[model samples]
Target: MNPLSIERLKVFPPVSNLDPSIYGPQDSALKEEQIICHLNGMSVQQAIEENKLFILDYHDVYLPFLDRINAHPTKKAYATRTIFVLTDMGSLKPIAIELSLPEKNRNGPPKCVVTPPVDATTCWLWQLGKAHVCSNDAGAHQLIHHWLRTHACLEPFIIAAHRQLSVMHPIYKLLHCHMRYTMDVNAQGRQLLLNAGGIIESHFFTAACSMEVSASVYQNWWRFDMESLPADLIRRGMAVSDATEPHGLKLLIEDYPYATDGLLIWSAIEQLVQAYVHYYYPEANIIESDSELNAWYHESINIGHADIRHASWWLKLSTPNNLISILTTIIWLASAHHAAVNFGMYPYGWYFPVRPPFMRRLVPNERDPDYTTFLADPEGYFLASLPCLDQMLHYISVLDILSTHSADEEYLGDRKDLSAWAGDPEIVEALYKFSMEMKKIGKEIEKRNGDPNLRNRCGAGISPYELLLPSSGPGVTCRGVPNSVSI
Candidate 1:
């Protein structure tokens, strides 16, 4: 017979009309006599190949068999066992039986089988299934399968993605490292990581699938919540406070109207940082400087005045390191904001305050600008954002490595050391490369806007923020007038 036709055969026997007369009086003896004889007639391989057998719990087969036997008018007692086999469809017979021996004698209900705990591999498979089902894409299915087969696991990839999301939020990289290294060590830890990966994977698949329909669909699915502001505003607002200290002096020198706006931008950056810190490292110490800065901001706003600014004083305070920190923060925020905007977030604005004005002017009307140009070219925006994403990924890798040993002692021994990591060759190199790429892309965006007159007016003319000099002793260098800042 053809294999397909053979697949249609019903191999197991029905027990609705079982005869009770064939068996002896004792239920246990009857069961043994009926089942063993049938099994001896056929091999296990034959039963499987011919699809002649069904595997199920003993109680499942027993209850129905008992009903049939009872219905016979001449009722007979049924065997009580944990496992049972039914065979011979023409002649209904309980073919084989096995009694379960409990390890300990205490139970309200008997279990037919004890399932093992889910492991990392099991979680990966579950995630893969969910991704495939949710996406319903052949390419995605094949990609997941390939990853599973090649990597022997998807934990690393999933964990990496999870780490990236964490960074995008206000979570500290150190705490994430701690969880991966110190907290989760055993099978339970591994399973938790797998579970996290599963969550990330679900969101990722959703975002991926949303991209297929429309940019609006994608943005809606991954949009960031605008209701609750990021905590970094409170935490990192101090940096802005310090930078804007010379605002009074800057105004005296040049009468720049946007100095307060710059303060606001810095304040927003702080909130963004605070959001991450609170989410990722709630236990982290609230620096007194931040509090002081918050007070300064409120006081400045209330009094409608800022103190002493030669622009040089602010420039001096803004040190290359501080500027880089601010830039890095912006990059991370942009990456997350880009993801949200790409996926379908409303407001459809870049996270940084500086960029939106320029982006707005790019359109025909600032009030009723058409987003078709912006929305249609998502891939370009995504490409523009890659450098920042790559930087975050690099940071995650560094953290993961540091987690393996002693992250605190090795990298964060002191406040100076913490800041020093910002200037590290690898990190600086990544940031520099990112700056160059953004400069290139920013120009492209500028050119695409088709407004030669408005080209450099919206602060798009600002030079890419670069670390003036590598760390030499303590002080940082700022080369320019600090007018135009590119992330």
Candidate 2:
């Protein structure tokens, strides 16, 4: 439940030793006592100094809509914040979670910080609290993390590419594979997945407010520069730049499968793009004089994502280095970034308790009637708290479809038309080199999955993280990086 799936789970900004301004500060209800006990001999401040503390905070984003959400007869939710400590083993372990209702006056602090029950007799209540948090995480995962970042944000780039670049353009050919089927898939999603009273509303905890929540995130957190893997890791305090480290950055969690493997794929793409760009635009003047290239970049920034088009952070494409970096980030987003978030749904979430999409009941207090029902039959109450039988089936079916690959799926580096670039033997050779690197990455991923030292992927009962494995057969194999957002 780190940034890949729960993208809003940022490193606790106030305590971060590096780039504390990456995310703005918020009022923290989490106390040091609740966290220090689980820090494995390290003090809470020491962990923060070492960039080990992280938070999945949903307080401000969801608090504004909780009343409207809870008013729905059958749906309920809480604005939750989960605190985690990075273990020595390089995996996140949850230390505490705080759930809250709206402040009575709308301007004051939450009436009280409602933490998970601690008494031994109230373990069921604790479990129920976690379930509510999972519901919040799952909803945000699907709507903002997956949809808004990858599918919605990438559309403008695709549109601008088609309008500006011709099929004969080298940049167009380079991106064609990654652009396949995206428009069609996005169109279908709009009509089904994101439509009002559609699958998202019916299955996710956000219910009627699903798109509203996504818009809020886009307005507040989405940025084109940070969409790149390296920038994203740095912004989240998951890694820090170091000249001596691999990829010139050291990951905070050494066993983070996503960062380890993603860096490999990301570097490979960068190398291939650098080679292609250098071959075409040998000098800065060549890049500056390319009308089609300039047109594509300007349209993408000025017309497609015009809201931040004037922002100083947007990279100017006057040099080959700049173009290469931009193209690499875009391809990465369409393939690996989308793959990391989209394909893991079934493997991690199919077991309903692990990630319930919606909660049917709120955590009950001692005075509440539902408290009696929970105590009498905790298991039954837990089951009843989840989406009903029909809803569960509906959610599972959607996950299965999203996770599955088609028989003819084209994975990253599986360029069937390498011959299309045959006119330029250098470009074809670069493509061949990229294809080979992807195959090697696949083998390396398998090797890591078998290495006992990486407990996150190799431990008993842990499914190896293969969502970025770069290849898979047809079916819900929970592996593969398709060339585009074909799902």
Task: Assess every candidate by TM-score.
Answer: 0.16, 0.92
State the displacement of the C-alpha of residue 212, model 1, in Å, after optimal TM-score superposition. Answer: 16
Top candidate, metric TM-score: 2
Tens digits of per-residue lDDT for model 1, 1-487: 0000001112232222223353211122123233334464665445444434432222222322233332332112121222123333221122332222122312111112211116643333232222222222211221222111112121232233343344522223322322232122324422532244332222222222222322222222211111111222222121122344542222211111122223223333344344434432343243233433234323322232122221222211123333234333333322222121111111111221211111111111112233344355533532332224433344334223312212221111011223433534543343245334434433443343343333212335532221111111221121111111111
Error of 2 at 86 (Å): 2.1
- Tell me the tens digit of each residue's lDDT in model 2 across 1-487: 3346422234343232212243223445667666667877887777777767777767766777888888877888888877777777767777777776665523223422334457744677778878988998898788887999889989998999999999989899899999999999999999999999999998888889999999888877788888889999888777889999879998878888988999999999999999999998989999889899899989998998887787878888988888888999999999998898888888788888768988988777676767788788888988888888878888898998988899999999999878887789988998999999999999999999999999999988988889899999999888899999898
> Clashing residue pairs, candidate 2?
none
Worst 10 residues of 1 by lDDT: 1-10
lDDT value for model 2: 0.82
lDDT of each: 0.26, 0.82
Counted clashes in each candidate structure: 23, 0
Off by over 4 Å in 1: 1-344, 347-423, 451-487
